[model samples]
Target: MLIAQVTDPHIKAEGRLAYRTVDTAANLARCVNHLLGLKRRPDCVLMTGDLTDFGRVEEYRLLRRLLAPLDVPTYVVPGNHDEREGFRRAFSDHGYLPREGDIRYAIDDYPLRMIALDTTVPGEPGGIMSDERLEWLDAKLRERPDTPTLLFMHHPPIVTGIEHMDVQNCANASAFGDLLERHRQVFQILCGHVHRPIQTLWRGVSVAIAPSASHYVALDLDPNPRREFYLEPPSVYLHYWNEGSLVTHLSFVGSFEGPYPFFDEQGNLID
Candidate 1:
């Protein structure tokens, strides 16, 4: 199955740029348009979180309009910047996610099972999975014991080696990792929020995090308290699963504008 993943759009109600610098909403729209222009569209689009810069009704209205051209299904979960009530009210009718508190469901088609978890802790920059969510996940995993599952959440369950981000990561991630260790059917875990393409292994399975369409977290591994991001090319992830293997490709939107060198036709000459 083909799944297009978009994360941390951070659209504003006023449709303004983030931090007075990055035009997040416009960047997201450009990314979406590029995805639509693809020759082979994905079966569905999965937006991990931070759908809005602030949880405003007007922002979601704009988001819905921006999402109008998607012929395929679009699914979303709340991030730290998202208000659950606002998201539920705005996207309730879409039928992509369960019409209830903080989405949780499994896609019954194709040999794969996709589970969306709510890890957003309200009014905070971090995340946590409540007991109810944990119970639900355990039961759901048991119910589909044989199906290879792909778990999606906004906060990644493992550290990304970036100290500042690591502090604000999932609070109950260790427990979640233990849960994954017990459930062998889980094939991969996908997430957002680091604002960069990060890959690591947890619970014997691979976990891949996609970069934000607006800006990227600066690649720094310093132990300092303060951290920052960089203005890199906006990107998305295309996850392809077939048979028993899964591969993900990171794609950046727009053409390259840089210098290049070419070798001579003789194949022995320098650039």
Candidate 2:
């Protein structure tokens, strides 16, 4: 089984730029086209979040149209940029997103028991997983203790060296980590929000952050007063599950050079 994780398109209504510069919608459309053209389509697309810029109704509507080309099953969770009510309203037919609560749910399809965690706190940039939400997660994990699970959320558990982004990281990370300690079945924790690709050992489990299709957060180590983003190459993660373990590969978006085979006519190396 293979899964693709795309994050943080930050789309705005129609022609508006995401931050008055980046063409987020166009970037997202390109990514969707790339996914559709892949030799092996991802069994599912785990859209981590920031589906819109201001969580506006129009923005979500535009997003649905931009994402219309994706034929694979998609599971979405929210980021700080997303509003719960608006997200629920737009994605109500997903059948898994709750009609009136934090958007948390699980996908039991394929071999992996995929879990989506709601970490976005409506009016804040930082994330907080409430006690009620944590309890729900505990129950879900307990119900399928032996199944290989992949947990998806918008906020990352570890603090990347970027100080500005770290300040807005999950506020209840310690509590969240403590909960994951008991569920060894959780093989991976996939997330978005940093707007860049990152990976680390979090709470004794593997954790990965998919790069945004819009713009990338600059990889600055020093603490800047404001966050900075750049037009770095965007990418998505293709996670392949073989046997019992999962392996993830990063695919840069947009067209590049070529596949150019190196072998000659008789399978000999070409100089």
Candidate 3:
């Protein structure tokens, strides 16, 4: 299976720039078109969140319009910037809220089961999974004990080594990790919200955080409040799962001027 993940577009109503900064919607559209133009199309496109900058009804409407060109199953979850009801009404038909009482869904599509979990906490920047949602996850895992499952969400369940973002991450990460520890079938966990591409391992499964389709969060190895990313070129992650192994690749859009390197099959230098 092939999946393209776009995160944290932070789209605005007027197609305006965010914080006098990035033109998120335009960047997102570029990434989408890049995916659409791929010779080997992805099976589906998964959006990890921050679909809108302020989570307004009009924002969602505009977002829906902007995303209409893609011809594949597009699944989305809410980020800190999203309103559950507003997001639902604009995109899905499941009563404008997650049918599972939480923004969680299971897509049963071959060798791997895709589970999208809602990590948005209303009025709060951080996220948490309630006891009820945890129970549901446990039950769902039990139902398909032997199936390989790939979990998706907005917040990374592990710390990203950045101070500010670390505080706003999933609060119940330990509990969530415990649940995954108990389920051997859960093979991968994919998330967003950090605005950078990151990878880690939690509970014996591969955990990946997709980069934003809009602005990037500067990768400062040191922890500092003054740190943030510039409006660098937007990017997306393409995940390929064959049999039970998962491989992820990053794709950047637009013109990039770099060193020219030409390689020969069995010869000397060609650059």
Candidate 4:
């Protein structure tokens, strides 16, 4: 099975730009088209978080339109920029999304058990995994200890060395990490919110962060305090699972030159 992960689209109001700079809607449109045109389409699209710029109703409406071409199953979580009320209203019909309470839920649709975790703290840039949430997750992991489960959230539990971004990361990450240590069935943790594709090990499990559909966070790991992002080539993570193993690939979006063949009819060197 193949799963496509799209993150941080940050779509805004009609004709509006994100953060007064990036044309996020246009960027997401290109990404959507790329996913649609893929030679091997993804079984489902897992949008980690930050689906809109300000969690506005209008923005969510625009997002739905942008993702309309995709006929596969879709699952989403909320980031700091997303408002729970607005997201629920916008994506109410999404069966996985709960109409009330925390948006933490589970899906057993395919071979891999999926969990959409809500780590967003309302009205705050930083995220927190409350005690209730922690217990909920612990219970879920215990239920199907043998099933390979994938957890999705907005704020990553691990640090990325980007000081500014790290401040807004998951607050109770250490506790969350401890939980992972006990649950060997949790194969991977998927995250967003940094606007870049970052991979790291958290508590002995693999944590993969998907790149944004709009721009990338500047790859600066220095001590000088500053925040930056760039319009580098956009991309998403495509995960393939088979025989109890999962492999991920970075699929770059945007048009490209021909994928010319190299071998001749006789399977010999072309030149």
lDDT of the candidates, in the order given? 0.85, 0.89, 0.84, 0.90
Q: What TM-score does each of the candidates earn?
A: 0.92, 0.97, 0.92, 0.97
- lDDT of candidate 1 over 8-123, digit per residue (tens): 88888664777788887778778988899877788888899998888899889888888887778887888988899899999878676676666667777766788988898889
Which should have the higher TM-score, number 1 or number 2?
2
Instruction: Give the winner by lDDT.
Output: 4
| Candidate 2 residue 257 C-alpha distance from true site, Å | 0.9
User: For candidate 4, lDDT tens digit of each residue in 1-271?
Assistant: 9999999999999999877899998999999999988889999999888899899899999999998988889998999889999998888889888889888899998989999999998989888887889999999988899999999999999889888999999998888888889999998999998888889877878999988888898988886647888999889999999899889899889878988879889998899
What ranking of all candidate models by lDDT puts the best one first? 4, 2, 1, 3
Ranked by lDDT, the better of candidates 1 and 3 is 1
Pull out the clashing pairs in model 4: none
Task: List pairs with backbone clashes in candidate 3.
Answer: 218-229
Write the number of the candidate with greater TM-score, choosing between 3 and 4.
Answer: 4
Better of 1 and 4 by TM-score: 4
Model 1 TM-score (2 dp): 0.92
Q: Backbone collision count in every prediction?
A: 1, 0, 1, 0
lDDT of 3 by residue, 1-271 (tens): 8988888889888657888778887887898789999888999888888999899987888788789898888888889999888887787653423644567788886557888888888899899877777898898899898988888899888888877888899888788888888998898888989988889877788889988888878776676765577777788899998867889999888867975666677675775
Residue-level error in angstroms, candidate 4, position 201: 1.6
RMSD of each: 2.9, 1.1, 2.5, 1.2
